[model samples]
Target: MEMIKIENITKTYKMGLIDVHALNDVSFTIKKNEFVSIMGPSGSGKSTLMNIIGCLDTPTSGKYFLDDISVEAMGDNDLAKIRNKKIGFVFQTFNLLPRTDALKNVELPLIYSGVSSKERHRKAKELLTNVGLGDRINHNPSELSGGQRQRVAIARALVNDPAIILADEPTGNLDSKAGEEIMEIFSELHKKGATIILVTHERYVAEFADRIIHLFDGKIVSDENVPKNNREK
Candidate 1:
């Protein structure tokens, strides 16, 4: 049931004459349906690790297995296919196309997968309804509030029924109330057996996850489970 396994993962960047180590021998395992949060301050390698885990970037040297398959062995085309099918990403900026309506935004993944128009419309509408945006499916990103837009993003992420939901600072742009609402949605998703990996520096936000992995200067500093009492109810 190990959804992700990383061993001695290292990522080095070449900058002019300097070698920058983004991740240094980091290792971890995340089981299926576990909610995990990765925390770090700026330049702490959180982004680098997220990129590797999301299959957007390869580790410079290490072993990465997704669902028991070796990610390190995948070609670029294979990686792209895997990313589209297995990993769903929710970004801080809500990455929706401003010109597209909510329904189209959510249907983007299915479209890429060559899902029939009728089937795509059905699935997208259902997901948007589940996320509390059924009535606003025709609204563009520009016409919706920040929270509503984020809901659309969440719906889009869930459209593919992906094995893992990689959410990076999903509430970063929201106000206190809106952020809490977004977290509530994530909590619901977790309850329903979604495997979510959230990256955030906010302690309150990180607390939503069942476990936290703290990163500093490209290495894991702490990895621990949250006490039941500390978790959001």
Candidate 2:
């Protein structure tokens, strides 16, 4: 089943007297539980596409469907609800609150979701444990290692059991070892039937995905399956 459908999507930004096209008639469909990566250089349309897919930004033209619902027609508030309920975002910055403990950070989403404190704590603990952070649940982000902090972010992303996970350069800040560890966690999530859409320019990281969508100058150049030989066993 298709979980996402983007058709002829275009994003144009008005800068001064000029119009900059960030995404040029982009189109793609992501099936449920499939792992995909979008790769491009800094100036490419990858980030723009991710924003549209995650509902952080809307397109200038064309249609978008999420789980068969017309996302293109949704209002701002509706889009916010969809983001909270259906999509999970993992950012490179490990965007946790410095003063908050891992548990509370993971629970933040649930708090906004109107879950009871007791239930939120329980779910947070479970997610923290799932991400190998059970022992550090009480530790603040300032006290955690870079990798651990990213793990906490991952836990938070999964706390809502979202239909899709959208990660933007999730391993960009980590060292090689930590980056590999993060990729391993993503691999585990994929094996467990989680749908993941990761955006990264790193070749090794892109290889971790089942399919890769290559973008250049606001256009998709290619979308292809990862060669079996390139796949991690």
Candidate 3:
């Protein structure tokens, strides 16, 4: 069961008269329930690749299939539907609404999907509890610790039961302890059968994924499975 498949994908951007190749002939497939990471330095095209995988951007050439559905032809409205139903996103900045409480932030996906108010509330509470934020469900992002805010973000990402979790630099802002905590939560999610694709520049962060795909100069330089001994679990 291939959850993501891309073939010879390319992304080109024009800055005035100059052309920038963000991704060049990249190809890969991620299977259902697999945990994979894309590792690269700044300006190495990892962000561009992440955008394409998350349906936030389209390739200039080649094909993209998300759960066997062709994404190359989807319009903005269609992409929004797929994003709400099939993809969950966690960003380094903890992209939560500052004015909202943790529970409300976590219910965003459900709200977008037209879930009933009562049910969405229940699901948000359950996910917050699962992520160890049960005691702080009513707190605003300002009231929580950095790690706790991220936990809220993780809860929000899972609120709608998305088929894939796309985390971009998810642990980039955290301290060592907090970063490890986030990775532990991700490991737990993978244990429960979620397909995860994370993009990061840190080796330790990338190591949390079962496999690491190294990107350089808009190309895959290496794709290797993590050894059992190297994994956190």
Candidate 4:
């Protein structure tokens, strides 16, 4: 199934008298349960594309369909609904609230969705355990290690059971070993039928996906499947 479909998408921003083309006629489709990576250098429109894919921003022109629903025509409220119900975001900076415990952080999306307090706590705790943070559920962002905090972020991302996991530089802030461990968790998620779209500049990180889409100057330069032999075992 096509989880995400875009065609001839374009995004333009006005900087004074100049119109900056962040994305120019870009098109691609990501299938259900496919693990894909997007790679690009700075100023390559990677962030712009990610924002559009996440429904945080809309394109200036062209078509975008998520799960067969037209996204280009959605208003702010509808977009917010899609974001909360269909997409889960994982950011590099571990966007957990400084004052909230890991369990509370994980329960945020549920609170937005109007889930019951008892159910929210149950799901959040389950996800924290799954992410190997069962004992650290009471820890705040400042109390946990970089890796543990990211793990909590990941657990939060999964708490809502979103259709897609949109991760932006998820391991960017961690040490090599911690980053590897985070990638391993992502790998395990993919194996469990998650549709993951990861955006990163690092080759090793990008290679974690089964396929990679490379962007340059607001256009797709290459889109190819990772060779089986080239993938890490």
Stretches > 4 Å off in candidate 3: none
Please write out the lDDT profile of model 2 over residues 1-233, one tens digit for every residue.
99999999999999999999999998999999899999999989899999989999889999999888898878999998888888889999989988989999999888878899999999999999988998999999999998999999999999988999999999999999999899999999999999999999998899999999999989999999998788765
lDDT assessment of candidate 3: 0.93
Candidate 2 deviation (Cα RMSD):
0.9
lDDT of 4 by residue, 1-233 (tens): 99999999999999999999999999999999999999999999999999999999999999999988899879999999889888999999989999899999999999999999999999999999999999999999999999999999999889888989999999999999999999999999999999999999999999999999999999999999998777766
Name the lDDT of candidate 1: 0.94
User: Each candidate's TM vs. the true structure?
Assistant: 0.98, 0.98, 0.98, 0.98
Clash count per candidate: 0, 0, 0, 0
After superposition, candidate 4 runs with Cα above 4 Å error: none
The models' CA-based lDDT, in order, is: 0.94, 0.93, 0.93, 0.94
| Residue pairs in clash, model 2 | none
**Runs in model 2 with CA error above 4 Å?**
none
Deviation in Å, model 3, residue 218 alpha carbon: 0.9
Q: Which tens-of-lDDT digit does each residue in 110-145 have in candidate 3? A: 998999999999999999999999999999999998
**Residue pairs in collision within model 4:** none
Report the poorest 10 consecutive residues by lDDT, candidate 3. Answer: 224-233
The superposed Cα distance between candidate 3 and the true structure at residue 148, in angstroms, equals: 0.6
Q: Encode model 1's per-residue lDDT on 61-81: one tens digit a residue.
A: 999999888997678988887
Give me the displacement of residue 7 in model 1, in angstroms. Answer: 0.9
